[model samples]
Target: MPITLTIPDGLLSPTAQAEAFAALTEAVLEVSGLNGNAFMTSNVVGSINVLPREHVLVAGKPAQAAFVELKLPEIALATPEAKRTFIEKATDVVERAAGGRLQRDHIWSNIVYAPDGAWGIAGRSYDNGDLISAITGSAA
Candidate 1:
């Protein structure tokens, strides 16, 4: 899984940005019930893109916004409740990180599911079964 956190420059302080990224990663693992899992923790990687303010937009106009995007296999966060929890928790992380400098509505979150066999790591393709087995340390 990868969590991409995109924000307009200056929306969050340097320290806050780093904290937000860490929190976002934790939110995913925590909600997915994978916290402390070595493989998942190490593989839950992504970037924090602090783009120019003008580059971020809302309805064709520039806006101070934050975007949280999670890319994972379909089998992850498989339940509706899990998805909901992640979204809510992610938005909360961004909001708290902003220290009231940004609006709640401006912080958006979404999840994109990779098709089976399309997810890969370490140059090896991993299907749903492979991922499940790797995560659980047992046959899927």
Candidate 2:
């Protein structure tokens, strides 16, 4: 799993940007119920891109909007309810990190899933069962 956050530069103070990233990561793990899983935690990683304001768009026009995107295999965050929770929590994280600089409407979050077996890490491919096994420590 990978969580990517994109925020327009200057939308949040420099320090807030860092906090926002951490919060976003936590939100994903928390929603997926994998906070204490070492392998899951280590492999679920991504980046925060603070781009120039002109680089971000809302409805095809430039705006001070933030985007949170999570990419995972179909089996991860597989339920509608799970994805909804992650979105809500992620949106909240963006709001708090913005310190009111941005409103709820300015934040957009999405979860996208690759087909089973499309996800891999460190040169090893993993199918749905492989991923679940790795996550549960039930297989090597």
lDDT of 2 by residue, 89-122 (tens): 9999999988878879999998899898888799
**How well does candidate 2 score on lDDT at residue 22?**
81
CA lDDT of each prediction against the hidden true structure: 0.92, 0.87
TM-score of each: 0.96, 0.93
Candidate 1's TM-score? 0.96
Candidate 2 lDDT at 12 equals 86
lDDT of candidate 2 at residue 42, scale 0 to 100:
86
Q: For candidate 1, write residues 4-97 as lDDT tens digits.
A: 9999999999999899999999999899888888778889999999999999999999998899999999999989999999999999999999
